[model samples]
Target: MGQEFQGGVGQVAEGDINNYGININLPDKPEFRGLVTAQRKELHELRAKCEELGDDPRDVWRRVHAQLGVCSISEITAEQFHEARTVISGRLEQLQEEADKRRLMGKILRSTAEKDARQEMLNFCDLSFGRTQLSHLKRNELQRVLEFVQQVEINPQPAAEIPQVQTAEPLQLREFLLMYKTNAAGLFLFGIFVGRFWS
Candidate 1:
């Protein structure tokens, strides 16, 4: 029946482009063609966005690699590419949200501290994660950084002025030697002992 033909997925003309102007290799297979064409357009857009944001496309591939267990994006199938696009989009969204959170956290810090709060947050994040910038942090790491900033802002701790008390343990030979180099009393005692015994 014509209803049977109409009930299933439709077919496209051979050698035609999708709505996005991307060429489709399998026109008779509309579902596959549409999915692949859309994926291609998305990937193209993703690359452009990465260029605009000064992000490496390798980061996207890294996410894809983690999911597919493939080494590179080229090894991914069209369906896999579509899935990767979703994953990449989620990451991009998370990065934007993290930036906004950082901006808000900076504002809070600025209100409480007299110094450059934004710079302070940046420095803290850099030191905490061993990364150059907040943007380099992964999604979970970004959340952790946000929590850290909030905690610090909530209970802003001034620099500790009190020196830490040394543990109640006997200093070893290497420790004593280091102490002798730094402490004038230790150095003088060492000199006296050497003069009396070695000379």
Candidate 2:
């Protein structure tokens, strides 16, 4: 009823569907499974932290890989997991602090600078940093823009300077008077000549 195969030691029995030759679907060792589960949990936590910080999860993973000297998170040993989490948490905290500082700088700019001054600052940011939004600027760039706005606020240029057209006005008036005198003199001479001819 069953097929037998010759082995190095003796004949091996090939069981039916009810009983197999070898159980190939055996579960993994507890320690290995536990390590994998722990790694997954750490990865999930890192991703969640990144989401809360508004950062890219890929960047966090890259940092972890670099620090752990691993190609992927699964390659990170149980011993290295704590270090990886620490790196990710520290980076997220730093990012949060930078974001808070940027917000404060933006608030100061808005409160102290006028609309035009703010606009000028934005233009400066665009030209210097290639970023127009205050949120996108780095800390030093934000500081420079804030300084510019303060300067503009302190020493504002005049709204407008009306150029002097007075010189051209006098020349135009003189031309008009000379033309009127010439026309009046010619008319007076013609009337005198006509009156003498009639007499």
Candidate 3:
């Protein structure tokens, strides 16, 4: 009869045989099975979250490993799991914020009248604020640009005035000629009527 080891698997007796003559070697720290399972599930969830946020899961894992001083997720202890979760969650939040800002910028640019309004805004930002991309601008700077664009839309610049042609002299001469012709015809008719009445 073989004695069962009360300690961890690390101190298990070598060459332990089962009833079917198969040697079984248990994993280290059998008591940590639950913790290990939970940690793996959390890691998978974190990776999915990274994908949803359009971030690289590998980079997230790198940050977690660096923060927790572990090469692999399996090596992370129960205490370190919380720290790793915090790091990953914070990164996801940051990514989400950046994505939202980008979406808002896109919406603002699309609301403009010009077909290439996005490029125009990019140029404006570069010239006025020294930022080539809207993404580079801070929240306040973006707000300023938004206000300026809205103001421009509200009060557009006036179009150039058309030059008037010099036709006043011609118009006056034409009117004078028309009046003279009318008066001459009226006098001729009056003279003819007077002669007929006398006859």
| Candidate maximizing lDDT | 3
The residue-level lDDT of candidate 2 at 38 comes to 61
Instruction: Please provide TM-scores, in order, for all candidate models, with all chains considered together.
Output: 0.35, 0.40, 0.49
Q: Alpha-carbon error at 99 in model 3, in Å? A: 0.8
Which of the two candidates, 2 or 3, achieves a greater TM-score against the reference? 3
Query: Comparing 1 and 2 by lDDT, which wins?
Result: 2
Please list the residue runs of candidate 1 whose C-alpha ends up more than 4 Å from where it truly belongs after superposition.
1-38, 47-55, 113-199
lDDT of 2 by residue, 92-179 (tens): 7788778776776866477555545666666777899998877766777777777677666445676788876765444475576687
**Residue 9 shift from truth in candidate 2, angstroms:** 20
The model with the greater TM-score, 1 or 2, is: 2
Clashing pairs in 3: none
Clash pairs of candidate 1?
A: none
Q: Global CA lDDT of candidate 2, please?
A: 0.71
Tell me the alpha-carbon RMSD of every candidate: 20.3, 12.6, 10.7
> Which sequence of candidate numbers ranks them by TM-score, best first?
3, 2, 1
Residue 155 of model 1: what lDDT? Answer: 39
Whole-model lDDT per candidate: 0.64, 0.71, 0.72
Residue-level lDDT of model 3, residues 85-152, one tens digit each, is: 89888888888788777876766686555443555566668888997677788766777667656555
TM-score of 1: 0.35
